[model samples]
Target: MTSRYLDYSGNMDGELRMPGKDKHFQNTEDRTDSGLDSLKDEDYNRIVSGVQNLCIPVSATPQDYEPEPWKVQNNEDGDTLLHLAVIHEAKDLAEEAIRRSYRDGYYLNRQNNLYQTPLHLAIITEQAEIAEKLLQAGCDPEIRDYRGNTALHIACQRGSLRGVGVIVQYSKFQLPSLLTCYNYDGHTCLHLASNNGYLAIVEHLISLGADINAQEPCNGRTALHMAVDKQNPDLMYLLLKHGADVNKVTYQGYSPCQLTWGRENSQIQQHLLSVTEKSLQYLPESEDEDSSDSESEHSDDEYMYDDCKLMCQGLN
Candidate 1:
């Protein structure tokens, strides 16, 4: 059998290789290849077996087992067995991958070519159960992907409320900080949820004390602003009910009602109007009484001026 070497870069080469490429592969003198021949047959077999376990498709039911030795093997993309299992939606294999990592103290938070961990893959694929598995294995949900979005951010954008719940429940991230975390584009999880009309997620986030009036850093648009722009009455109602300030303006100085002008969103317009009226009703009584007294005094002055002008006209 030909002897092959797996490089740290995930490239496999035969004994004959270019000089620089062969640096990862070693001769009997340097022994830099991590001593492939020194390992017992059982250890090598276990390593190969773990790789094969990860190769199992998601549709098939894989038996539960720990792949302690599979740590040595990874595909060309730097994706470990856990990353592959999550990508393939292989629930059983994914669970086993978590088990192996936990038992052997392996890194489950490793990033792939795209800078995505297994948890990121799970959220992208909308596989809530698989995400739960990764969380259970103590994968860091706060890891940002190449797009600068955490798994929780993806969950909100993808409308995976269950995944969000799993991440919040299992991950050690502070809820307030995570909720306020902005992506590269200055969008918080609440902004994504509102823009996508994920009402349930929005409600859940609000219940968890997510800032209903949280503004995007770049545009200064709040969740209420997003709800109005999307013309989603239900979202508007939900946001307003949660105390989203309808009168709050964006960087463009456009309030939620201002954004509704000339649009076809009558329901949202009416809702904003109603909320605004109710808010106005709560104005301080001192201010209202002062305005009323000023109005009456102005009326009396106008009447006296009119009487004096009539007498002057009659004399003339």
Candidate 2:
């Protein structure tokens, strides 16, 4: 399990606009309605109207009522209905809430029990389309819920190609960012999928252009380090086939093969050697800060990455 980076402090009192600016909590319904009324599009207008028309009844706030963030609704395990709706494909509710949030210009949220949004919920629930819709709706893909896992992080953790596909569709999705995204212990998405033996997600992410040799913040370990140390051969093969740099040393200067040697794991050692040879022959190229030959360890075979990281290894 990774560290859940679940700190939520957005659109609070000052971030919102309300008639009664003096009363921060009053920004709830009345002020929210006013904001919705400002949208220029008619469709957007109707959405706000519908949302106000269907406002979930809040217990009458006393004139002295104050808002507590926790007072927001939650489902089992403390997931909000919105959280469950997107993930579980409760579309009618999802769409309606989505529309309302958009109309109100406040749908972008990732503050659930695990600091996840409806988009992440959709991924967890296997609702790829809903996740796609949410991305197009301008949700923050970088938001890490309580688990220090972004929606991309969770989709990779789930190891579902379809879910990863939906996430990868976003043009702004920075594949290299996944390398930096860490769970509490500082393992990257690659580390998570590899350690869990989720080969599909691992491959899909690699295909979508994740950096195979990217280092995790904790101890500067790469995904290969985690997989080999954990004795996951399937993961080792996947990472190697996808072009992970096996020779690269961790902070302690130990490569994935070193772990295998320490444990006398011949199987892993052989796999690393094979992959390292392949990587040396054909290093991959990404269009990020580290693309030049100086950064590249050796001449690559034919790995190609577009504007964002595109796992175009096989295609090329």
Candidate 3:
């Protein structure tokens, strides 16, 4: 049998025995070079396990010990070390804290000065894996901070479909009701995604059975209207394919086709006009006529905050 030592720089030496193993082997080289043969043998695995079990980190003064903090959890910046860990790719320490939080139900909504969550930072920084892990750990996906926007909205605004997928996985139907989910700008996640040319996010929102034609207050802009404003022909094509009413008018009396026709997206304008005329070939009787009148507008602003508080208390 041969003795082995593991070093911080991943250097392995045969002469240096593992700590606590005072007995040295005479035939170190004869037992096969290095620990490869031992690794393949069960007896070697047991020896390695025993060595690991006996290992302990070197101690230091309280100030220097554990010098690396995982999160920047302070009132000034809402970011947690977990947020930065994911942002900067700090794996081991972040994983340890994440496991602890998972067990203790640590609801980390720490925002940096930006008032964003670890999840929000994940999306902004394009950390798809960390975002997924954080969501699974129960960081509220529907949570809104100072700007009154949810993680979904932030993902959409940044056009991070990868991040959006991580959020939508948790946010499908689970959420804190009060977030109105409508931001202070009076828009939904779908609205922001559609407005910002995030075709993939729009597709995901629609796949979740979101109202494709839902409008915002302050003049009633539909997804199609916002898509038109972005001059995105593909987005217009997507909205129309998803049953956007080309003839349906905004409060300003501008229909999708009208807005389309006025845009720089001449190809979209022509295509939308053609579709509007083609759809008029035959139409169904008014089923959602009255339903359309009562748009999904939230009259009470504080309702969302109150609902969020109630849900948080319940979870607590």
Candidate with top lDDT is 1
- Candidate 1 to native Cα RMSD, angstroms: 20.2
Instruction: Tell me how far candidate 2 lies from the true structure as C-alpha RMSD in angstroms.
Output: 16.4
Ranking by lDDT: 1, 3, 2
Q: Per-residue lDDT tens digits of candidate 1, residues 138-218?
A: 667777776667899999999987889888898555677788877766778989989999999999989988888887654
How many pairs of residues in model 3 come into backbone collision? 12
Model 2: residues with Cα > 4 Å off, grouped in runs: 1-81, 87-89, 103-105, 171-179, 262-265, 271-316
Off by over 4 Å in 1: 1-69, 103-106, 277-316
TM-score of 1: 0.63
Residue 8 accuracy (lDDT) in model 2: 22
Cα RMSD to the true fold for all candidates: 20.2, 16.4, 13.0
Q: How many residue pairs collide in each prediction? A: 0, 16, 12
Lowest-scoring 10 consecutive residues by lDDT in candidate 3?
279-288
Q: What is the Cα-based lDDT of residue 138 in candidate 3? A: 71
Q: Better model by TM-score, 2 or 3?
A: 3
Shift in Å, residue 245, candidate 3: 1.3
